[model samples]
Target: MGSLDLEVTVYSRHSSNYHSYKGNIGTVNDNILNQKFNAKEPYTVIHTDIAQVKLSNGQWGYVSAVIDEANQEIIGTVVSS
Candidate 1:
């Protein structure tokens, strides 16, 4: 079986290392590099009461989080191999 890797990062127009994600949205056959930082999102495409599934690179990698919606801090995280 093949293995995959995953990561979370933050980025912004400024140096927001505290809470933002900075990465390249992959193009056709290209790669996507992302950076994660502290951020507050008033709007989201989806919201769940609990951690459902982690984000993945479409390979073997997956990232799930147990987050504190009040603070937006991740209480727990799991990365698949």
Candidate 2:
């Protein structure tokens, strides 16, 4: 009879600094919703982000998107050059 052996390996990864913002001006309202999301409420958190993009005429522009955290859906979007 022959003996068989098997081994298993696992890998785990995590990041503590996943999101960040810099160069913010004074008097920034960091908690506009009164920490509503911490209460486990729906439609209480909204997130917005801006991205630099290229236009159709080869020009640089900006695009911003506002999303609802509860459903992860975009509520508003804007583009400008």
Candidate 3:
């Protein structure tokens, strides 16, 4: 099993200097092909992207996924309508 944590950061310029706030959105398991994803890995190592698709019911959908570079396998997936 692997871990893919999602975070959202807010930056406010109206403040005196600059204020930033970070919040945890959620986590995803990205263990694919028996490999764990880590930031310390080399470039082109682990990749993630969002794909938009048309639902069968004539609606728009967004699919987010994490891919493992070693085997080019999608480890985790999330879909939203």
TM-scores for all candidates?
0.28, 0.51, 0.40
Best by TM-score: 2
- The lDDT values for all models are 0.43, 0.66, 0.63
lDDT (Cα, tens digit) per residue for candidate 1, span 1-81: 135564343221322233334577665552332233333562222223432232345323446766654466656667665
TM-score of candidate 3 against the unseen true structure: 0.40
RMSD vs true structure, all candidates: 16.1, 12.2, 16.1
Residue-by-residue lDDT tens digits, candidate 3, 24-73: 65786765635654434434576789865656685658899988766677
Clashes of each: 16, 0, 0
Candidate 1 TM-score to native:
0.28
Candidate 2 has what TM-score? 0.51
Candidate 1's error at 57, in angstroms? 12
lDDT of 2 by residue, 1-81 (tens): 135564322232222443546567568667666765542455677779998655567555889998878777789999889
1 against 3, candidate with superior TM-score: 3
Better of 1 and 2 by lDDT: 2
**Model 3 lowest lDDT segment of ten:** 7-16
Worst 10 residues of 2 by lDDT: 7-16
